[model samples]
Target: MDIQKIRRDTIGCEQLIHLNNAGAALMPAVVANGIRDYISAEETGGGYETADKYSAELDQFYTYMAKLLHCRSENIAFTTNATDSFNRALSAVPFKQGDVILTTENDYPSNFIAFISLQKRLGIEIVTVRNTPSGETDLEDLEQKINTLQPRLVSVTHVPTSSGLVQPVAAIGNITKRYDTLYLLDACQSVGQLAVDAIATGADFISGTFRKFLRGPRGAGFLYISDKALQSGLEPLFPDLRGAEWTGIHAYTHREDAKRFEDWETAFALMAGSTAAIKYLLDIGIQEVQTRNETLTAYLRHQLGNVPGVQLQDKGKHPCSIVTFSIANQEPERFKQYFKQHGVNIYTTARSSAIIDFTQKGIEWVARVSPHYYNTEAEIDRFMQLLTAIA
Candidate 1:
């Protein structure tokens, strides 16, 4: 990977350090320009006319996403964000009273709330599988749960937002497959940063965002639906005209493919930007990106670990690019402001943000520094210098 060329293409590289990629990465020139050009065209030619003209480009977004996800174009549906994509996929599952959603403790907080909502609205049961000492999903406990009590769906987050903990997703997928149960994998953090194959992951539904490692603009994401899921007649409970066609007064037939998960209207400019971002990653190659990320993260962990009063908070057998740590005797807001003052980008994750995991770890909050492959080792060194002076 050409660090110079990568940093040059990223507009903010020279101005400040960006260590909050897991929150949102620096968008490259290709993605920004694509969005700007499309929006400009829409402003002059009108939205409808511009969309009609760039119909092929808009359609090609799905094709690019299909390549990234290892799925067919028909199985991809564009959503607003990872939450929207996950919600759509969750709603599609035909859950009745007493249905169970077996998940892990480190599942996304938003997803956990969604599951709780299901429990309140419907009589759905939410069961959590055991976590290993290192905070990864325990395959033994998961298999035992599936064997003893059947779950309607096995949902797991590929990477938790609170830390660098990488869940054993593929193994969980295998467990779900054994029971012939539905599986939903939250690949929002894993997709662009980590190489994720839908078929290999064995997830019936995969939800992701382009704004993170993919470096696309916000307000745009995509969902992947497996052939078996679609063939089994699963679709979003709230279907719009874009997803289905009305046949009679109160009857409608949803599309056979993943379009049934999307709404009618879409932000074409964002779609254009997302397409360009995915194309950029594909050109660079995800495997190469992963290699670069591993080196950066390893260096970060080592440097941060040695910093006085800095406690490394991330845990997993194989952690990804996200690096979370708590500074003793430092307020989270203070930590956030200190980095901001130094022209560094990072986020402070609160215990409320991830109650289960945070409460278990006994920390009120932690500062998150998520770096991408585009970042330089020199930047990490400077990051350490600034952090060492934090006391």
Candidate 2:
């Protein structure tokens, strides 16, 4: 691996020990500088003129995202963030009265709330599969639910926000395909940390943010809609001129691609930065990055487990880069603040962020420490030493 190139790209290593990659990975120099350059152009040229001047670069955003997710460029749409992308995709699915929407218990709170709100409004039936003993969605229960209910949509988070557990997305995809159910994957945390092939996952729609493991600017994300979805005429709830053409006074035609989910206005500067971020990740090779992240996380977990009074909260047969834990008699916020004071960055997850899972597990809050490929093993050792000292 080109360690020198990686080190040069990431400038944050010198400043702080960042362990919140799942929340927002540190942006590389290229992405930060790209956004600055775009903003400078906007000052010299008018906003509209600047966008026109860099339209090709903005267009490359979709192309780069498509390559990252292994889908066609036409099947990709840029969104404000992962939540925005997820909401848009959910809105596109026409939910009728008595329709069933099946999901896992570990689903993100925002997504769970959206489903409940839609169910109340549309009178749709919402079903949640039982979790495995290990904290992941039980495959047997999921298969049984699909066989019985034949849900209108099958949604699952590739990686839950509260823990390091990675759900069996490929297996779920196989089941969804067998039943011809519309599959939607929430890949907010898994996109850049793991290899996400929309085709292999068999998800008709996939939503993810660039800020997390992608290490891009905030307020930047993308969605993937399979060709089959486009052919089936699925569209956003409010399609604008950019998404659909005004054919006549009372008629219109939606685009033949995933662009139908997008609006006209966007942050061109952020899009440029997102494009640069994607290129940087691709250059490093995602497979190698995933391996590096896994190794770092494993080392962190092992060290944390050895610390007195520190209990790792993540439970699963296979885990990702996220490491959740709690120290005895330590409030989540206080613990996080302690780390912050020591120049270490981490995040706290309250029950509200993942109410269903946390509430069920009797965990009110947890401290999350997530590492990316750029993080070193030495950082993990230092973090462990701090954790031990605190304990």
Candidate 3:
């Protein structure tokens, strides 16, 4: 793949140093133009008429997503964002009293809160697996927990938002398969940065967003439910008309496909834009993207490691593109503002985001810089120079 040509297609890099891809990636020109054209068509014609005109392109959304995840189109469901998909998938599993939910300490805050809320309401038990000394979840401990607890469900985040540490998801998936446990994977950070195959991952369900690494619109996401899950008659807590059809006064029928988790109305423009974005990534190739991001992150880490009083917080056997660090005498927000003033985009994470992981590591907040495939080595060098000057 031509790396320079790919970077040139992302116009935002010319205006600002965007290192906040973990938050939201800049949309490529093709994706932006696609969304604008769809909106213009809607204004010129009626909503229904405009949809009819681009029905084939809109349908490609599911096809492209399935191709990306290496899953069947029937197993995919369109959602507004990762949170929406995660919540919908979680709601589908019925949690009775004393049911156990085994998760990781590095899980996203929203997911942790959701489990806590469910536990409070339904008398379910929430169990968090211990993390290793390097901040990744301990696979041995996780297996031991599963053997002992025999939990109702097993869920984990492939790549956590708070840090760049990649969890041992495939190992966990192997364990789940051995015991016939339901596995749910939150791939919000890993979907575009790494190869994701639902069957290989052994996950019964997976959820992710398009705006992060996929560089799509902000409100586009998806969910994948295995055929076995569908066969088991798992449906959302509150199924809409699109998800279920009212057969009679006392009966309803849910769709056999993963669309059973989705609602009737959706943002068609965003859907089209997401499809274009996936096509753009496919054109560049995911393996090439991963290689570029890993190289950039390693360069960034090498430069940042030399900064005075700066401590890299992310520790794992293998890391992705997220670079997180904390300065000895600087506040996270103040440091972030310094970077902003210098035209470098970054973000800060508090202990509340990953409370168990942060507190265990004795960290309050840290500055995070996440780079994508479009980011160049020169940009990483410049960011490091700026960090040194500020420090």
Candidate 4:
């Protein structure tokens, strides 16, 4: 990869040592410009007119995402963010009283909260699978739970937000397939950073956000509904006109495709921006992006380990770019503020973000520093020096 050329295309590379990619990545100039051009057109013309004019670009969001995820364009639905996408996918599952939704202890917080809500409202049981000693989803235990419980849905976060732990989704998919259970995957942190094949992963429903590793504008996310999911006739709770046609005074027909999960009104500019950002990543190739991300993060982990008082806290059999660690004697807020004041961008994850995982690991909070493909080794070294001094 041409790291120099890629960095040049990124807007904040020169101004800040951006290591908060897991929170929100720095958007590329192409994506920013694409959004700007669309917004400009909207201001010059009208919202509907601009949307009609750039309809192809807006539609390209599905095409690009389909190509990136190895699925049909008809299977994609654009959403406001990852949480919304996940919620839409979850709402489609036919949950009844005493139904089981099996997942990992380290699953994303918002998703777990949704499960809790379901448990309260519908008497659905939220069953958490055991994790391995090394902090990965225990496949053996997961299979056993599936065999015994016959869960209504088996959900897994491809990469949890609070840690760099990557769950074995494909392996879990294999188990879910054997049990004939629906599999939902949250790929918010892994979509652009890794090459994800939706079908190969056996994910009936997958959700992702463009604001993170995809380097796209905020307010843009997507959900992928498999052919099997479409055939299942699963419908989200609330379907707008875009998702369902008002055929009669009290009746409507849901869309045959994944659009049944979408809202009528959307940010066309954000959609255009997502299209450009995904196209840019496709041009670079996901394989190459994954390689660069692993290389840079490996360097980051090695350098961070060398710093005294910096306890490396990532726990996955195959960790990627989202690096988490804690200062030996400093508070998470203070450490985050100190790093920000020193022109090093970073964020912190608290126990609330990963209650089960953090409690199990005996951590109150930790700093999360994520590096993208555009970040350089020198930037990693500079951040390391800052962290060393703080330690």
Candidate 5:
């Protein structure tokens, strides 16, 4: 990779040391310009006419996503964000009053809240799979739970937002596949940071966003539905005209593809930006990005470990680019403010973000520093110097 060119392509590198990729990445110039160009096109022509004119570009959104996910284009559906994708995918699964939904302690907050709502409204049971000693999803415990509970759906987050803890989705998939249970994998944090294969992961539904490590515009995400899920006649709880054809007075036929989960209106500019971001990643190669990111993460981890009063909080067998830690006597808000003042960007993860894990670990909150591949070693050194002075 041309490190200089990569930094040049990212406009923020010159002014800020952005380590908050988990929150939202620095959008590339290509993506931003593409979105602006699309908006200009829409204004020049009519709204509907512009959409028709850009039909090929809009369709490439699916093609690009399919390439990133290693899935068929027909299986992908656009959404406003990862939360939207997850909600839509979850609603498609028929949950009964007494059905069980299995999930992990490290699942995203929005999904956890959705599960609670389902429990209250439908009386569905939410079972949590305990983590192992290393703080990963326990495969043995998960297998036992699958056999005993016969869960209606097995949900797991590919990577938790709070830390570098990456769950073993493939192993979990093995158990879910054996039991013939439906599986939903939240890949919002994992999709762009690492290479993912829908078939190898064995997730019936995978939800993700392009705004994070994908470096695309916000308000754009997607859901990947497996061929089996489509064949099973799974339909969204509320189908709009875009997703279904109204046949009679009270009858409608939902589309067979994953687009059935999509609504009528969409942000075409954002979609165009998302397509450009995917194409950029594909051209550079995900494997290369992953390797570079791992190197940067290792350097940051080593430097942070050496700083006095700093405690590394991330735990996983194979942690990704996300690095979480806490300063000895600094409030999270103050810490964030100090960094912001220094032209550094980082975020904090509250206990409520992952209640079960945070409670078990006795942590109220922690600062998260996530660096992408475009970041330089010199930048990491500068960050360490700033942190040491603060300490």
Candidate 6:
């Protein structure tokens, strides 16, 4: 990896010690310029006119996303964000009364909320699988629950937003496949930073966002639908005009492809930016990016471990770039203020976000510092110096 070239392309890293890639990485010049130019064209040529002129570039988003996930272009659908993608996929599952959704406690908070809402509205049941002592999804317990419960769908988060713990998604996929149950994967924080192959996971549906690790513009995400789901005729319950054709006064046929989960209108400018960002990552290679991320996080973790009064809150044997820790008797907001004052970027995860995880850990909040491949060891060292003095 060309560390200097990567950091040079990432202009924000030059201005600040960026440690919030999991929230939103600094967009490289190509991506930001792509978005700016598209918006400029939209302002001058009109939205519809600009979309027509750049239609091929907009379509390339799906092609690039297919490359990222190792799926056919027809299997990808565009959405507003990862949660939007997940919700659309969830809507496609033909939930009946008393249907069960088996999931993990460390799942994304917003997704768990959606499950609870589904339970209340449709009388669906939600069951959480047990976690191991180190906080990974217990595969043995998950398989046991699937055998006894016969769940309608099995959902898993590739990586939760609060921490860097990467769940054994591929292994869980094997379990879901063995049970012949539908699998939904939330790959919001894992797609660009990890080599996520849809074929290897065998998930029926996978959701991802470009704004996070992909260094793309906001308001754009993509979903991957397995050919199995397409052949089974699964689609969003309320398909839009873009998703289906109106055959008659009261009839419509959904698209044969994954676009059946998409809406009629979208931000074409954001699509242009996302196209550039995904192409950027594809050019660099995901495995190389993952290696760089592991190196940055390993250094960050080692530095944080040595800070007095600092409690490392990350779990799992293989934590990713997100480093979560708390200073003794220090409010999360204080950490935020301190980092802001020092021109260092960081984020905080609160108790409300990860109910089970935070409640069990006996904490209300933790500081999340996520450094991307563009970040340098020097930046991590500078962050450590600031943190050590604060401690």
What are the runs in model 5 whose C-alpha is more than 4 Å off? none
Clashing pairs in 5: none
Off by over 4 Å in 6: none
lDDT by residue for model 1 over 176-281, one digit each (tens)? 8878689999999898999988888889999998889889999999999999999999989899999999999989999998999998899989999999999999
Q: Per-residue lDDT tens digits of candidate 2, residues 39-67?
A: 99999988999998898888898888889
Clashes of each: 0, 0, 0, 0, 0, 0
lDDT of 5 by residue, 4-27 (tens): 998899998888999888889998
Local error of candidate 6 at 53, Å? Answer: 1.5
**Which candidate, 5 or 6, has the higher TM-score?**
5
Worst 10 residues of 3 by lDDT: 1-10
Question: Which residue pairs of candidate 1 clash?
Answer: none
Q: What is the Å distance of residue 341 in model 6 from its true position?
A: 1.0
C-alpha lDDT (0 to 100) for residue 339 of candidate 6: 87
* Model 5 weakest lDDT span, ten residues long: 172-181
Whole-model alpha-carbon lDDT for candidate 1? 0.91
The residue pairs found clashing in candidate 6 are none
State each model's CA lDDT, in order: 0.91, 0.90, 0.89, 0.91, 0.92, 0.91
Which digits, one per residue and each the tens of the lDDT, describe model 3 over residues 110-208?
Answer: 999999999989999999898888878788988899899888899899998888899878778888988856899999999888888888888989999
Residue 15 of model 2, lDDT score:
87
Q: Which stretches of candidate 2 lie over 4 Å from their true place?
A: none
Q: List model 4 lDDT by residue over 262-368, tens digit each.
A: 99899989999999999999999999999999999999998888887778888988998899987788887888889889888999999999999888779899899
